[model samples]
Target: MVEQSTRATDRPLPLPRANLLHLLEQMVLIRRFEEKTMEMLALNRIRGYCHWNIGEEASVVGAVTALTENDRLITSYRDHGFAIARGTPPETVMAELFGKEGGCAGGRGGSMHMVDIARGYFGGYGIVAGHLPLAAGLALAADYLGEDRAVLCAFGDGATNIGAFHESLNLSKLWHLPVVWLITNNQYGMGTSVHRASAEAELYKRACAYEMYSEQVDGMDVLSVYEATERLLRRAREDREPSLLETLTYRYPGHSYADAGKSYRTKEEIERWHQRDPIRLFQRYLEEHGILNQGEYDLVERRVSQKIEEAVKFAEESPFPSPDTLFKYLYAEEGTK
Candidate 1:
């Protein structure tokens, strides 16, 4: 019975010193990573469709931090943030983006398909809401096997319109599977605003049709996201109750690398969201609380910048997959032919 709120809270959660710092660091790191990624995409160093998570740091970092080591994480194509937040090395992520063999997916999956199985992060799905069924399947497996594990499935607002969203929710509720369905409602799904697409713009209400518990929180506030996620996950793990959480956030960039995100969005709209930037909001909370000072914040920024540079360097130096090994990993059993 998590208390429900759809707005950002000014009060900071009573987190430990280390946890607070980790949250700040992760948000800053993600912002820097996306900024660097944007630069690389512009310079043509990284190829293929790239979606920047410039404004959704709190949604990613807060949710990921709530999960245990054994929990599974799955998400939509806006995945780099989730991957980095889940502890996949920046170097490997950049390499994957660069299509180098050093990538987490062996450079085969590229940006939309980043996978790190060892870290319990299932690959990102490219199709809209296509991964929802897979997430339900994973939850069913854990339920059937009597495993003490839960799954967190993340997707965008537009995904709700897809039939699979309803199907997954119905099944998860009926079966009492351990899963937390997180909707990162960044206001828009691609170029269209959520209002223009979803009939029930308050997405959390959709869970009511399936008799599942649902709540919405301010995605720009990392503390609120963290608290709600932690409670929901606890219920999922302990009581085997599936739930839906909608985080009200926004993405600064357009849908992908190709779209400039300006055709459908106004300059004023983008600037307004920037004023409530997740990283800046969290930083204000931390500084005002006497947890992080200007000097320490600068140190964090410098450290993250260096890490991003190293990641870029690693991507630059890593080799692309050799053509000779192209046929490898095509099947579960090799040498069949």
Candidate 2:
């Protein structure tokens, strides 16, 4: 059976006001960034398949916030929030979405392949379940090199059934790799619901086969996610204990920009999930704790709005990659020779 977190009524550990506000601000930034991305896609400023993490802010922020600067991170294609939370500049992320030269990937990777090794964000892999083994390898390298670091690998619910997931987890457990596998179960794997896809829907229990410490969290509750991830990360860092974390979150938008999001799921179901939107839930929690008020909330909204506007301007003004450099970074020199 999957271990579920207690309801929000139990209250999370009391965090400092500054940390709480920081978490709130990060969530707002991600929400605004995603909203602006939708607008940009509509304006044709960004092309190709784009997935927005509109309602899953807490899952992204809480997990990333728990990681230290030296820790490594890898995630699947829906990665704007992950990159932004990990301290990648919004301007560069936006520019990448716009396919401009100022982007983190220099405009070539676009939305589905963002990368910033300097910030410890390994990549935004586009393939399904493909990055799991690579994350395991990163953990192995850290252990082999005697580095005091851990790897946090994030993937969608759909990936749970893939072979790579099992292989990586088994090896990670066998070798005692310092890694945390975060399964962002946003209810639907693309257009298919989790119920339709898997026999054992409570994904956290899947970790049992590998005998890894695992738990399912209320992804809408930012504090719960943060506390759980922080604890697991500490275990991995200190004891080299790998973990599997399943975050039960929801995505308001469709699998991609092209999806209307209503074909498979009903409007009422979507509305119900919207009621528990991670941003609003966390905002209410802050207000209840007297850590935030209307004025401060308004200020955050305005600041995030302005930040997104500036990022858009930056992306628009940035140049596209020159055609002359088309073949750059494609192949290794030794291989080409």
On lDDT, the leading prediction is: 2
lDDT of 1: 0.91
Residue 330 C-alpha lDDT in model 1: 84
215-292: candidate 2 lDDT, tens digit per residue? 989998888889999999989989999999999988998899989888999999889888888888888888887778
Error of 2 at 126 (Å): 0.7
Q: Clash pairs of candidate 1?
A: none
Q: What is the C-alpha lDDT of each candidate?
A: 0.91, 0.92
Give the 10-residue window scoring lowest on summed lDDT in candidate 1. 1-10
TM-score (all chains, Cα) for each model: 0.96, 0.96
Worst 10 residues of 2 by lDDT: 1-10
